[model samples]
Target: MWDDWARTAQPLKGKVAIVTGAGRGCGRAIAQGLAAAGASVCCAARSKSEIAETVALIEEEGGVAMAFAADVTDLQSVTAMTHATIAAYSGLDLMVLSHGVALAVGPVETTDPVDWQRTIDVNLIGSYYCIRTAVAPMKARGAGKIIVVGSGQGHNGTASTSAYAASKAGTWALTRSVAAELIGYNISVNELLPGNVRTQLYEDTFGQVISATPAGGEPISSKRSHEWLKAPEDIVPLALFMACQPDIGPTAQSFSLMRRV
Candidate 1:
């Protein structure tokens, strides 16, 4: 029974994937989902304990995974993650850049330049670090999948989020440029823009916005409010589709779950 079950569930069987910022939320979900589909996932995150928990969950479910301590902003850390993955799993096939940071909201004038810099460093630069290094083995092998978790703000601008918006937009552009470079290599690079899911980041950032508003009328429109935000799991199917189906999937393109109802 165990052997049969394992064989049936192994689509990504021996493939190795590195999911950054996988300590929690979207990254964690993506890591587990890939593992469930038979991928030996390396859950990379800055937090050791958090990533350890993620790996534990995957192992508990009979999936193969490893928790890695890594900071996406540092190419060295990201490169080490890829190196470790190759050492453990023997080959690299997928890279999920799900790491991101959302700073406290405030008007442009009120926003701190340092805070803004940090935002770009995490969302844009950090992603670049992961991609630049991960592409090595992929490019050498001539096949791989790079799934970037983007934000709606990248395409559609939002108020009081200047830094985040710019950072995300830059990340998407980076995705397109890299996709073009991977054209004939069989390496698919695409950006997966997530919807308004009430994860820890969302609650910490936007929750404050709603709280600061004067009592009585709602601050944001109903369409963009908490009531409309879907669970993180709701967006996982599309993420998995974009991830596991690289050959037949679109590359140098961007897809989003922003159309939630």
Candidate 2:
């Protein structure tokens, strides 16, 4: 059954997608997934070098993609990136909010004020700016898809990571609100809460913490017999499913990816 769906699910052909934070990590995976499904992807990120690399990879694989550098936390930069995507693609069918920063793990009482502010600025405020800038074009076209990359921590609580968790929780709410408001215009909005994907960002932060502890002492992976962690590629299929099947009735919801028990 799933094989049949995959063979027939090329619904996004000729569509245009904008993936923020596409320089690396899960963003790169999402961009490539969309491109593989026949969408022209606009890869947006703060680092021009990494974004270019992502674009190059996509093009090498016979996919259509272009790189654009923008600081999503800055409103003007977000606007410029959106406009550039529209000008190039002539239309925008999808917007994926995947840009975020994860500060060092620390208790709420000990976290620096600046770091907390930066978390909110990039994770929450930046997502809002991207969605706001993309809405105008999507509304004009009367159809679109918006997927916000949230975290499992957002649904529950994780010790010593209040800022990241809170930012992601806000993203969940933002997704719900946008879905409620945009459904009238035929735009679908949703949130994807990834459990633990092996991306550069995840490896740099959580990998170090996990490595320092013994197998039995690790938080999430402590009980797992297999030491392997899921990769960004594993999460991209669900993202592509959501993006291409926007007409599905699962808007305003959050889905998590985790190994089966």
Candidate 3:
């Protein structure tokens, strides 16, 4: 179903977009979704190979996209990426703040403060930097869409996920603040929690599939774990919907595609 859209749709025709962490997983899938919708996309990540892979997939489906290397944690890096996008695609229309880093599950006291801070640096600070830089060009154009990829963890606390949860919670609030700042200017900002994407990162970090969740006993740590859970591809449509920046309201809103079905 998704592959078909990649070749036929043009809903975002001529729009320019930037998707961070696009080298793989959900980021890559969202990048594909944007390109499939006819947006000229710039895929950004720390890995050149992964970014290239994403670009290749888009090209294979006859979509327009390019890869860029940038560390989302650094302001200068993100700034340069935005400027580069302007040079290539003229302007920015959509920005998907999807890059994230996870901390291992352990006792809060056992966690190094440095590790906790690093997680915040990637999941929260990085998002702030990208949002800050992307907004300028977007504001100048008097129109833009910003989608912050939040987590269910943000809504409530869970054991062993303090850093991830806290950071995402911060991101969700930040989205509201940013939306308030730009809503009157015609730009729309919103949050979308892609409920439960089954990406390789989850598999690797958890060492099991979605079934192995904290509440679920004895996780099925195998390829089957990858099956029952929603894949990155499943979240594409919602991300695309957010990309369109639907006018259900003024801005600074939040949406979710929590169900795999």
Candidate 4:
């Protein structure tokens, strides 16, 4: 099983990583996975209690980690967080921009301006801040890996998800741009589409679990197959694989687990 493999692998030993949105869902899963791979991880998020739980879980598994409360929307907060991670682990080598929001889930014409803007603030701008702050440390170290947890919505259009789509699309573009800019510094930046995992964000936004359909049958969602619904743990392996890649590994590319309908 995957658990057995994780226990035996130490490919990332001595590396230090920072995972945003480490409170729960895919972010928490990735953080735990990185720890299991022998990296010192910093579980960062606005929810102190939630990140504490993540750090506790990592500690319970005998992995090195710490919980840091940080608001990604604020540049100063993100900067302090990056500094703290470096201070704790002596340096930074990996950054995972996994925090996101999908508050504007209605027709654009009828959506609240505040909610729409907030969605962008949290998902797109927050990612920019995290990347901007983390880049300095990584550049200083001469090598780093940045993984952006993107969405299927970014690749194609979908109804009632205008803001979320725009933000993720922007993030995808940003990932490519940053990767190109950091290539000379030996940093690799890539995006990971985790499919439609059954996280709290999914329940709150869709209120329905994506169900499996018969062979060759239509799915519930047109953008992706309903059967793509997965547990957070299902994403860990791909994340670990990307994290374990060489310094010259693929960058500006997207690794997706979601199937198109």
Tens-place lDDT per residue, model 3, 173-215, is 9999988888777788888888667887676655522422555
**TM-scores vs. true structure, each candidate:** 0.90, 0.89, 0.88, 0.93
Off by over 4 Å in 3: 2-6, 208-228, 246-250, 259-261
Per-model CA lDDT versus the true structure: 0.82, 0.82, 0.82, 0.89
Q: Candidate 3 at residue 190, lDDT? A: 89
Question: Arrange candidates by TM-score, highest first: which order?
Answer: 4, 1, 2, 3
Best model number under lDDT: 4
For model 4, the stretches where C-alpha displacement exceeds 4 angstroms are 208-220
Model 3: per-residue Cα lDDT at residue 107: 48
26: Cα error in model 2, Å:
0.7
Candidate 2: residue 159 lDDT (0-100): 61
Whole-model alpha-carbon lDDT for candidate 2:
0.82
TM-score of 2: 0.89
lDDT for 109 in candidate 3 is 70
Tens-digit per-residue lDDT, 1-261, candidate 4: 666687797888999999999999999999999999899999999999999999999999999999999999999999999999999999999999999988867666768899999999999999999999988889899899999999878887466678888999999999999999999998999999987899989887764213322335443365453557899999998999999889988999999987755
As a TM-score, model 4 comes out at 0.93
lDDT of 1 at 235: 62
